[model samples]
Target: MARVVWHVPVTTSGPGSTTALRLFRLRDGRRCAVGFSSPAALAALLGPDQAHTELGEPALHALTTPLGVDVLVLDPRLVAPPVTAPATPAAPAPTALLQHR
Candidate 1:
């Protein structure tokens, strides 16, 4: 029987561009890799537009271990607050200039 594969996120600059495995940092500043059990699970945390690939558990570890990333976070929970747009000040109305006679 084949081993269960996990969904691993990847980043690509554009079409036909080389892809790189997306790595994450822990709260302690340690680097680690992330994997999800399914595509839906991956999308839920990273959004629907996230790109991902499938790999077995061993393969995921092998790829990350070489980069000093030994930890693997499976189905991680959201710990940080959601990002919001900054409030911008409204622009002042334009004033008409008087012409000198």
Candidate 2:
């Protein structure tokens, strides 16, 4: 079965945050870009909290901000996928670890 499309809602407030909570979803393993692009339009999206940021990038999502990194990153809340979940009762970590060592 095809993997389910994961939808993420990103809300930012405080310095460099959006004035209102905005939602963005992942598409084809990449973030689907938002369309609100004018400098004034972008500014309106940010309340006093994010007023200090300079408006750049016309095609930016309303809820995203650079976190000292030039590239986008996966949200920290995303845990290792189900495939990486704890081993089943049939298989345990200690047995595997001892076998390899």
Q: What is the TM-score of each candidate against the true structure?
A: 0.77, 0.20
lDDT of each: 0.92, 0.36
List residue ranges in candidate 1 displaced over 4 A.
82-101
RMSD of each: 5.0, 14.0
Q: What digit string (tens of lDDT, one per residue) describes model 2 on residues 9-89?
A: 234565564653243344344433332333344445443233233223332333354422123322223234556555655
- Badly placed stretches (over 4 Å) of model 2 are 1-18, 33-90, 95-101
Q: Candidate 2 — number of clashing residue pairs? A: 0
- lDDT of candidate 1 over 1-101, digit per residue (tens): 96888899999989999999999999999998999999999999999999999989899999999899999999887889889776897678989999999
User: In terms of TM-score, how similar is model 2 to the real structure?
Assistant: 0.20
How well does model 1 score by local distance difference test? 0.92
Candidate 2 weakest lDDT stretch, 10 residues: 67-76
Q: Clash totals for all models, in order?
A: 0, 0
